[model samples]
Target: MWSGDELDLDAYLARIGRPGGSGAAGELRPDLRTLYAVHRAHTAAITFESLDVLLGRPVALDVKSIEDKLVHGRRGGYCYEQNSLLAAALERIGFEVSGRGARNRTRGDSLLAVTHAVLVVTVEGEPWLCDAGFGYQGPREPVPLGRPGAEVQQGEWTYRVRKEEDGILVLCLLRGGVWRDLYAFSPQRYHPVDYVLLNHYSSTHPGSSFIGRVVVHLPGDGVRRALVGRELTLLHPDGLAERRVVGPDELLAVLDREFALRLPERDAAELVRMYPAGD
Candidate 1:
């Protein structure tokens, strides 16, 4: 596990509301519980998207590089980078987190090998599914693999987990009385290089959705995004809100008011350009 001083530790712990990870205060022991809590908190706070793609960044995989952009630089990233950072923090907080590659489940399931990075956490002799990298349909808690009776619902979304042949873990969402394929994976360990191919495809390929727009994903019971200045839309559990933040200053103001996140001057200009104003 990665051990660090108080600054990173305090920031990470405060994010999970478990100071020093735990002290016999929460529902369960700090070990597994801390992992789940942090997973939820991180996903709730940090979104997974190529905002850096909109900002003209060369999204790198190394935690130090990612930390410089996200932790130190006040920026956000997509799955490969975001999940990697969260995994590092989990390791630092004394959880046994192993990286696992997966695929997007929405739309038609991709034929590609497990090309995206998720995680499997072995907690208390059980493998728990944990991911903070998915922007939309994501697990708000660590899921017990093969536990049919176990389910979770937060806001307007619900999730269910099952184990299949060869111990591969399957996760799906309960949608319209149908099982929606979100993603599936096995507990096999993962490496950083496993995601590099995905990173390359998502970043450079013209057909990849990440390159085509400016995506600002802030997930809660609500989510909002302004896709390349075309329109701004927000999805809440109850309803939806849409608008257009036309110029740089107006976009900054909207960012401040809506998300309470301030953007750097240079980034502000790039945001407006990435999502150029519409007449």
Candidate 2:
């Protein structure tokens, strides 16, 4: 059950500067602390990048390697990496974290590609659905379970869950009280193979948008992304700003000036060469 008990908790805590197994005494619910640890562990550890795609490596699912990247290499991982680690941590902390399956809403997106994850936790005799792997756009708090259409607020994104016909679990976000599609899921529960097949399509497959651009979502802050030769866009709480760039320099500038992420001179030239559009 603990896939990452092998992962060094001390190292993970040190990497994030949160007390890992540290002393404290208060009304802190262990399960709730488990959730908070996972959130901090995930955000401070993983990142959003196409480095794996560019490097032609299949996404890996080992704890040691994940820890290497999270604690040392300054890398981020996708859902399975982040959530699996969370599951391991919860299991270690004596909380039950089960793996669940979710679907992306995009038309024609492979159910396999759409497959996502969530965790079910029982806190003080009440079950709660917890997910911290949906980076950038994630819930700041755990959504209560045993109820339909319950809302949980992270910071900016407000999320709600609905269970529909045939046991289909729909988890969504509220924008103006209307449910907006974030993803729908089933409690069928997935294993390693389920994730393995899904990860393949997410990183490959020419039709997958993940491969067509650089997507760096900074969560409640919104998204920063660039499509090859098409556009570079940034979203804000109030509005959106976008532009078309001639090449990499402009794109790098956007990343720097807009998102405050600095791209090295060589890396900027490289991405531009890879995604040149009309002159």
Top of the candidates by TM-score: 1
Kindly list the per-residue Cα lDDT of model 2 for residues 1-279, writing each as its tens digit. 547458666556555555645432122235676676566545544454454554456777667776776466545556766676666656655676667777766344445445566677676787677675665445545677677776666655567778888887766765544556667776676765676677677778786556756654334324423333345544443334455554555766655554345544665567667664555
Q: List the residue pairs that clash in candidate 1.
A: none
The number of the candidate with the highest lDDT is 1
My TM-score estimates for the predictions, one after another, are 0.79, 0.77
Q: In angstroms, give how far residue 213 of model 1 lies from its true place.
A: 1.0
Model 1 residue runs over 4 Å out of place are: 1-7, 14-30, 109-113, 164-167, 222-231, 236-250
TM-score of 1: 0.79
Residue range with the least summed lDDT across 10 consecutive positions in model 1:
1-10
* Ten residues in sequence with the least summed lDDT for candidate 2: 20-29
